[model samples]
Target: MRTVPGRLRPRSLRTRLVLIATVLATAAVLVCQATGLTLMRSWLVGQVDDRLTDFRPPEPVYRDIADGTAPAHRPPPHETLPSDFRVYFYDADGRLLPASLGSGRGEPHLAEDITARDPADGRPATVPARDGGGSWRVVADSGPDGMRAVVALPLDSVEEATSKLLWFSLAIGAFAAGGVMLLGGAAVRLGLRPLTRVEHTARSITSGRLEQNVAGTSPDTEVGRLGIAFNTMLDQLRAALHRKDRTERRLRRFMADAGHELRTPLTSLQGFAELLLDDPDMSPARRREAHELIAQNADRMSRLVDSLFLLAKLGDAPTTEHGPVDLLSLAADGIAASAARHPDRRIALAPLGAGYGADPAELDVVEASGDPHQLAQVLANLLDNACTHTPPGTRLQVRVGSLRAGPRTGGTDRPGRTSTGPPLPAGTPAQVIEVADDGPGLTPEEAQQVFDRFYRVPPAPDALRDSGSGLGLAIASTIAEAHGGRLELDTAPGAGCTFRLLLPASGGT
Candidate 1:
């Protein structure tokens, strides 16, 4: 007993709409028929009353009675319709009365057995005649001379007219109801026109038209809003997909950069290593120098590769899954490691005004959340940037503190919209670590693009050429963002570059 939307037959919207309209139309017809029946009944009764009002006795009897004379023979009233209708009547005393104005009932009258003791004046009733073939209207009242009178007539004309009207009304009602149903169906289809466009757009998507977008212009009703909404949805999906594609391209470029970065040092290391292994006799000093050089190149290559791998891991990391890590210890350790690696070089610690402290230990373990290894990589990249750009005697600094990262990526500090420290925690605060150098640093243009993949500082005529892959800064920035923060660089011509790594503060989520 499993249910799945995939296995079920989806209902059609158009058919459903039409069905509802048809049912309503049927109801309308029934209502019209009932109304028509009632109205026609009233009209038929009026006709019967009209015929009854015209009921009058024979002319001779009427003349005799009108002149104040007694009638020799009394007769019933009748109408002559030129066809096969028998006119018969009864006197007030219940005896068969003759018709002086038309043909009498043929042979044995159909209404002969339905006689009633003189009916009350102004009172009338229809009685079913023999074999149920027809009916009789029996009415009684005083005559023109104060004499009693009774009238009986076959109801054939009234009945025939009633049957004709009933069928005519039903036909008219059915036709009107059918017209309404058809119009209703057209209206429903017209109303759902936007849906048809949505369907067309969806089909286009399925057929490899990634750029196809829903057109919302020129709608005449609420369907226009639907078109707009659908187009907006497509816009969002297209943006998401485009961002994904850009990420993939950047990844491929990063890998290629990493491989290229390693190749140069690896080539030197391999050549030196092979020389040391050769049987050719060499001086001890020369051999020692070759081995040391090879080891140094190998170390450089190893660090470069590790940095790139860390950047790649940022996107791959699961969101909100890693435990919190203290960024203070991480950055401090990285600075120390960079100093120790190049002991001959100079390093310094400086504080900034925004609550960032000067002491190396002053970089307290700020509670940040992320994969420890990736966070450590972010720290190492910052250190590497400081190391490469600084002169041997130039000062290097690292400062750690907290700041709010706003929901607006463009930058804002408004209340409720801003976050503290990092944008991680579904857009929250962060632990910011700034690493700076006093070496002749970046030009304004270079500072803006330094984090771009493959970008490099401009080479001066006599300056040292950049030997490492140009991806170090870019890789570091990628890692910073993957942790739900951004890398901001402060630099200008003649002013050293300062790099900031913002990581989400712990407890933010």
Candidate 2:
């Protein structure tokens, strides 16, 4: 025979539980009823047997039988036997005997010698009548007059009682099954209320209600545990979705900023090409100027494209190849390059002073675990940004220090803000690299948005903003983050902006 699959099976938990309860209840009722009925039938039959075993014939009947004067095959007078019972007599030779003339001591059509010897005791035993009317329990023994006699009782009453008991047992089993179904179904429904709530919550989530949660009862209960687990899962899912939304917003802004940055260079290149192509009689100087403009715009576009590419790579996977990088040497090199590029600007390198809480030699030998090339780019970008943004001859300083107390080593414009970094094991020191410029400082808004891609601090009234592609600071920040560190800005209206880079110090002890 074919069987149904599991998926197609009944899905209601209450129904299944109630069905099991009903089956068990029915079985119990049937067993109890069967036991009781069997015992009752056994007791009733025993009563009949007892009566037959103790049966005695009257003195007159015995005397008549001894003298051979009693009439045989006649009904007893006055009907002394029970209505449903019969008595019989047998001779010494096991033949049917006549009853006393008017005593009615014979059962018609009942044969003498019907009693069989018991297998265990070799005594005359009660023999059941096989006729359809009913059965008889009979016993044979010697009477006072030495005449063998048999007493018999009908089994009709016991059969009727057993039949009634069978019906009663069946009724009780059916009623018990019905009661179990009703009560068990209610109990299952009540106990599974928490699961029902969880199901509702799941459906709500599927329908876009991510904030819904099941109200828990008690942690010690099974349903309570389920509720707690379900709520926790919902919270995690909500947080993940929130993160994805933030990422998408950032991606949209990145696209717009990239497009705007790229268009400016392209427009400049196009304008320069048009200017050179439109005038055949243009002076050599003018042509040279046009060529310079075209080359400059092309370089700008190339740098912007490169920065965008680097940002993309970092965003995709921030983890990169790692090695020990000498922060002091990298900072010095960047400072030297900046000084040479801007000879008119005052640029200096500052070793970690007493404020850094480290030995002077240790500051000079500051090293961090990171990608060397990326770290070099970070320092170069910060130096270039500082030089480009500040006035000519502004004092610029590059400070290399090991932070014993993290971002708190230097007081910030904002009291508690610090560069983001991976959590270090206790007692591990961090390396801080800062580029500070004593120039016209930034406003709060500019400081907040300084690291955003394509963001430029509104140029000073006397300075042109054309010097930057707006991607330098963003790229620097991305590189720092890829190396498991962060870039932070601290500045005020008058206090010059300081860009801090925090990275994990190399363990060389």
Candidate 3:
């Protein structure tokens, strides 16, 4: 098993998927924004340049230049020009010259001022800059005399209009991008509609639903592959469940058969015993012989049938109530009873290490929560097994106590312990009852299979006859599980064996 680390948690599926999509979308937005901004700026600059290039002087200004009656150095003037562009003229030098409006080619704003300037054109000329942040287009030319002409326009208006258009484009682009994302998400979700149905179907059949499957026709699509995988998993689970069900049924049938086979002899013994008791003239020797045979067979049948019945019940009929059951007392009673059956054999209980066996403190009475009938059944099987296998004088020990699980089981105690306790609650308390014997025990491998129904391990070649119907340990194991507990074994060949039953403790929710 792999351990899970919480401090360094693994990333979630949803977070990973959402992050991938967000990153891709963000990259697309950056690419689009860059492309649009570059193109808009270039286009606006071209339009401004073309508007300035198209400005030209009127016909009167040319006429004046051809007639040679205008100022000697002044170029033909414009009658009108657009607000975006400007033109200026100079006498072969880069100078700020005067504008001659309407007496020449292009139109200008101040006509009277241009006419008032002297014929001599020797001073630097300037256009009053608009908004103090404007650019002027200057065009210079010589006129009819020693005169000059110029044009000036503010750049503020052209730039302001361009800025407004760019801002509007930005707002529209942002809104469109957001809308596209929403629409894209909706389209993706809509296109995968079949997946939702597939998910619901998968959830419905976690176990034993062999007939349920996704009947997907579009195997080429991604969603179709998912459906195929889901159906495949269901098939495997259904097969496993079927196998388990068959195995359980077979076990139950074995127990039922053994119970009937043993009951016949038991009924005969009881009937004969009653008849001998009622006889008025029978000799004492004859009566005692019949009585002993009847008693021996009766005891054997009782133990065998009881074990079979317990196994049968465990397979199909478990009572729900987990009430009080003194498991310790049950084991002691079984030991005393088994000893009485074999008077020739000496079966004894080992003191629980306190030496003072008569004192309450010296005794360990494990008061666990479970069905008394079931616990007694378990105790009898284990105790009987100890007596049958070991030497006549070997000691039998039963211990009942609470078990504390480690971190893996949440340290909570389960009330019953045979081998596996209830999954250790994180903080739950659990109980365990152990039946140990000094008799020659089973090997590890044999012990493991002993709890399986009808699994009879052959005894040593020189050993005595087998006494059990091969269902005793199996029944004991079943009773343990009925209380949400497990039965575990500790022993090897020639070594003593201990069977432990672990369960949930009292006050466990």
Candidate 4:
């Protein structure tokens, strides 16, 4: 596209606009001037013709010529005419009677052929002078005794007047064209001033000044509307750039944390292998313990990798098997399995609205559409998080039921309470599966980061052995989102934590 040089292209809009306006104005002026000149010339010629048609010679001059006794040398002394007018006489035989009438100054000599030809009718006609001086407007009419009288008027005055007018109009047109060009150029520059400002703002933004914005955003005129749209586009661009920058920072941090998590288990496996290689005479029991430790580390690394892969998959496009799954049944199964795993944890199914003080017999089954396996994993992760973080024998209740639209169910805002979840619309038919514990809950700051990958609360001094890989809640949150739901946490520092998995209820209320 750049191969062609831009010299022929107008670089400035102001120049182009002014040039076009000036050209059109000049063209219109020229046309009007030409039309005026044509009309003026025609009117002047018509005035001369009218004068010639009204002219008539004295009666005695005509009677003398008819009697063949008129003098061929000059007109009678008593007869007088305009200095530019002339009269000639011709007989029935079409021969010129040489005597003519005139003021004797500036009279045009008529051609011989014009005098010889019969004057067929009385109408004005132009004929060239015999002496080649100029042209004449002449009219011929019949007179007494078959004599014809021809009257002639010189056209020099009319030509002179029209010529002067033509020159004057040209000068005026030239002046007007120049004025239009100058004033039009100034007007165009003023009109485009706002666009110039917009260009400057864009340049500043391109040079890393993301906060720069265009001014004069009124939507009244074309230029004003352009500025409004330009400012809007700039705002959107700035927001998109900010989001991209934030995503990059998060990605970098995630990579660093993932590497650190993988390195620990890898380092352990290497240490154990090194120990085995250095001591070939190790006892069977010692060797068995080393192998078990290696196996445990491998298993831990495998679970972390799988969680990372699952999170990545969910981030892309998550597909779930569409079917009706009972949240209450899933909750029961999750409770039983969790109880078996941590027999001392005292986990149980809570009654419907149990935390809100509703009767247990009023409980209703909560059903949603999603993959059961993924839902089960979400439940297991929530129970495991509660069990691992709290003291043994902590009273954990898993509640599964539908929440009617409008106010939040079973919870109210309190000091230091925070919710980290996608908002559930107030009009949606929502079913919630909540895993609440009566143990020490998290602070607002911890709650905000709980759903982030590889985030974990500082474990208790005696609970290091039970601390997890920190991806359980993150994976659960992802699964919840994949199933068109959200995992919400309402917790305060010592007020206990409630993790609610809210999904759209499959069957309407």
Q: Highest lDDT among the candidates is held by which one?
A: 4
* Candidate with the larger TM-score of 2 and 4: 4
* Model 4 residue 348 CA deviation in Å: 5.2
Estimated TM-score for each candidate: 0.63, 0.70, 0.44, 0.76
Model 1 lDDT per residue over 185-299, tens place: 7998887887888888889998988788767645566767677777788889889999899979977986787677778888999899789888468798998899899988988
Which candidate, 1 or 2, would have the higher TM-score against the true structure? 2
Please, what are the lDDT tens digits per residue for candidate 2 over residues 168-280? 99999999998988888889899898889889888998998878889875799998988898888888988998989988998899898888888988999998888877887
Alpha-carbon deviation at 255 in model 3, angstroms: 7.8
After superposition, the stretches of candidate 1 with alpha carbons farther than 4 Å from their true spots are: 1-27, 42-128, 131-158, 174-222, 269-301, 318-335, 344-351, 354-373, 404-430, 453-472, 504-509
Candidate 3 at 243: error in angstroms? 4.2
lDDT of candidate 4 over 31-125, digit per residue (tens): 88889989998898899888887778777888776765756646676776766778887776666777777644455555444343445546888
Residues 284-395 of candidate 3 have per-residue lDDT tens digits of 8988888888887777777676766666667687755668876667667866777686565554444333222344355566678788877776777777776666666666
Assess candidate 3 and give its TM-score to the true structure. Answer: 0.44
Residue 302 local lDDT, model 3: 79
Steric collisions counted per model: 10, 7, 62, 1
- Candidates sorted by TM-score, best first: 4, 2, 1, 3
Judging by TM-score against the true structure, name the best candidate.
4
Selected candidate, larger lDDT, 1 vs 4: 4
| Model 4 residue pairs with clashes | 72-99
